[model samples]
Target: MSDDRFEVVIVGAGPAGAAAALALAREGVEVLVLERGDFPGAKNLFGGILYTSVVNELIPEFWENAPIERHIVNRRWLTLDEDTQIGLDLKSAKFDVPPFNNTFTALRSKWDRWFAEQAEEAGAMVICETNVEELIVEGGTVKGVRTGRDDGDVEADVVILAEGANAMLAERAGFRPQMGPRNRVNAVKEVIALPPEIIEDRFHLEGRQGMALEYFGGAVKGTVGSGFIYTNHDSLSVGVGCLIEEYLRLNMAPYDMLDEFKAHPMIAPLLRGGETVEYATKMIPEDSYDSLSDLYEDGLLLIGDCAGLVNPSIHHEGTNLAMASGVAAAEAVLSARKSNDFSKARLAEYRERLEDSWVMKDLKRYRDTVHFLLENREMVNEYPDLAIRLIRRYFTLDDTPKDDVIKELWKTIRSEVNFLKAARQMWRARKTML
Candidate 1:
């Protein structure tokens, strides 16, 4: 093997690439991880939760040393109306203890760096500021990567693409179809800083406990989008995201929606005296399992968002899926390497492993969720309004009688909601998610 050739080459140092590098390095494989940013996390703009199961397995008790912001012990799912909001708030003592299995909030800038460091510690070569221009294919078989450098054509026995939602390299290589606005979401986020005590008091948090608030309905100004606020140690990660097609169709400004959401009657006071510290934008592939591209060919494998591994379920799970795919890819490569085989047929094991893992199973389970939501935008736009109206009237003292209010509410629902549509959606949700 030449000096520049490696057993495996992983593009993008996000969770998937880093995880693969770590696992492969531990197996003493010659793996190289390339990042286009100045550092692993420098270009990442995620402001969401990370489920720790996959990562925790990679690094036991990772929370002890990781750059985690907060351990979420409280969850709030809100539906905002014009002047009112309704939602569920559940706090669990079960999630407050060690491991914090529920989830935790983190800034990708710091978290990704730490994760990549783990890979480096395990003997993986992670190079930053290296742009992998294209995959080096020879006679319809994947071989290596061509980077933007004088001596940049680095050969590898196998290449794992973890290039994220844009997946330009994968698209250019014909490994996957170009992602469309219909299946993508443009999210804008801001990290608003406040005193730790103030944040604690505001979000009803105690100690290192945190809250995650997810908003629907008017939060996106009646658009097919959603908003979120996750408590950090001393900052709040607040953002709104909507389908790219909806954004373009409505000529909606994501930042403008964020502003309106911040000014919400219930949300504004929580950030009354906070200062915005960081702002970022990211494109998330929300299309479920059906939209996933081809998983493997020749010596190439696609994992994470580049492979459409994001679960578009209400959970919005991406990180865990990414890590799982990474680990699975590493295992497949190790198995293939044992036989000194690097063929498309051999690499196909990666797909089988992913399907056998929760990554594909969970995604397949929620395959119809994004489609159902797109077909029924009213669930995010009008239904929340209807719900708030009904609940408000029911609680109002001006109600003449309880039974009368119930009858009136039923009449309002019958007039405004398409029962057939509602029934169909309910059935679809039951069949797909339940």
Candidate 2:
């Protein structure tokens, strides 16, 4: 075995690790990325949507060369109440043109491997099938990592921990918190294959154009969770997720929740002929500013999910944050290398870079969002039901008088969440919404 040491060691070859590796390697620095999966994205899943602007900033006009499935021309946010759905849909023809504005949905199984290859091409040595077990520290500073692979103690000037939700290695170095039930969401997503034409027609998309729909309310049964459907080339990515703590309290099994979500009349008709292709469940980190541990400790910095960079309410909005954090980490590493200061104080600049980006600003904005949902679960579950019942009544076209319908609306609202609780919830939601 050869004694090969890199300037930086990154664990987990996901979007964050790959982005950091590509950025650093392009600067002519030795970067090593280690992954436990046989290949990148092998164990990853999401209702995967990749916003191209971020990717283009890392690799210009990346869509032209990237293995993307389709352009997203339509997006819908659906708030559901059993069989009823109220949604906001957005579509633009310009979104399909050069340098697409919105993102496209893709299967991570294919996209992640290709993304990692870009880092490899840029000269970052990515080693997959290697499990990083612990961080190597010396004189109160991280120096490298110890992997589970035989004869796998690799040394580096700095180690960036990008290992997803199980950010144990980073926590060992005191870079993050111990995983708490409320701070994470257990998500299960499945890919269901429909014919390409059917998908296009169902989602109302043009040639290779796709749509994304986010579900609320009944999906997670009032928890601060969601169900989603995103269009791929010939398939629909569908799933539901909720806080692990809430699931425990509600005694909700994820699969049971998924079953209820898919059976909704609105979703069922759309996925009529599709066949389930893949089944996967993983924990998603929901905490942000409060969840972030020591991002920079001595000669190491943590990026991506390891830094607890996810916004819970939005549903797996971590990839963009991860890439941004990785970019910041890479820039900081390059600066430290040039100045020859691998000290903890020198690497703290990475924190400033993150604070200036949306990664930190947005997280700070929703810092109290998770607990808000925990406190007021009825807004998501019961309110939607009340709203739907009112809509159904207003549009029933019965023999009842028109004025009576208006009176019914008030009666239903009072019956279902009660005015006082609704007012308190509206106030709480508004606090962190803006």
Candidate 3:
């Protein structure tokens, strides 16, 4: 064996890659993690919401020393209709207790680097600023990767691809195909600085406590997109994500939609007097299980955004899936190393593990759901409008028969959205979600 080569080589030192590297290193395996950015997460962005379960699996009680913005205590989901908002609120005083199992806001630029350091400390060698160009192949059996340097053809028994959204290497190797318009979304985000006290007052929270507000409807220029505003210690992460198909049809720059969302009457006040500190944009794969491409080959495993693992239907839960897949890949590699077998048949265990776990099971459950929602265009536009109109009518003070109110509701719903269509959507949602 060459002195420089290792048993496993992981590309992209973000959550999945770092998690995989750390886990493999902890198991006493030789792992190498490579990052293209100047550092592990210099090119990464943050919505700042991270689940503790994912991190705790690798580093139990991670918040003990990690740079966490705040342990979240409040959550609000909002549907906006012009100037009005319909809200669902959930808050628990118990969340402030130990183990804080939910989540906290974070900056990836700092967190990813820290995670990479953890991997390094666990005995994985992480080299930064080295971009892997393509996978080195031999007679259709996966072997290793070729980077962009003179001695760049680094060989390994196994290669784990955790490259974020582009996944160019994965597409090139035919492990997965390129995403269609429906499978992709363009997300634009900004980190704006505000006083910590102002953030507390505007979001109606006590000292040092943070709140998350997700906005729909009025912010997207009536498009099939939503706005998100999540609080940090003294900064707010605000952004919008729209399907690539919708973005092209509207011929609008993402930044324009970002501006519209900020200027929204409901949003503008919270953001008032705040200064935009940084801006970033990235592609997120939101096509659910139907978009599941190849996950395994002879000597390679794909994890994280490279495999298109974003569940936008929920809280954009890709990182957790990434970590889980990383763990599965590491386990498969460890088993194969034990048996000295790197055949495709042996590597199929990773896929089986994925299916048996929540990552693949939940994704496959919602595989057709994205298409279901996209097919029903009115749900994003007309349906929400109908709901707001019904609420407005119920509160109107004009003298009218009480039974007439029911008739008015029916008339409005039928005129704005066909009853048959609405009923079909409800049925489809129930089936698809289940």
TM-scores for every candidate against the unseen true structure: 0.97, 0.96, 0.95
Clashing pairs in 2: none
**Candidate 1 CA-lDDT value:** 0.88
Expressed as tens digits, the lDDT of each residue in 405-434 for candidate 2 is 899888766666566777887988887654
lDDT of each: 0.88, 0.83, 0.82
lDDT of 1 by residue, 151-216 (tens): 898899999999988889888888887788888889999999999999999888898898999998
Weakest 10 consecutive residues, lDDT, candidate 2?
311-320
Name the runs in model 3 displaced over 4 angstroms. Answer: 1-3, 396-407
Query: In angstroms, how far off is 187's CA in candidate 3?
Result: 0.3
Please provide, for model 3 over 240-347, each residue's C-alpha lDDT reduced to its tens digit, 9 standing for 90 to 100.
988888888889999998998898788899899999999999888876676577688888898989987766674667777888888888888889899988888888
Best by lDDT: 1
| Global Cα RMSD, each model | 1.4, 1.6, 1.9
Alpha-carbon lDDT of model 3: 0.82
Candidate 2 deviant stretches above 4 angstroms = 415-420
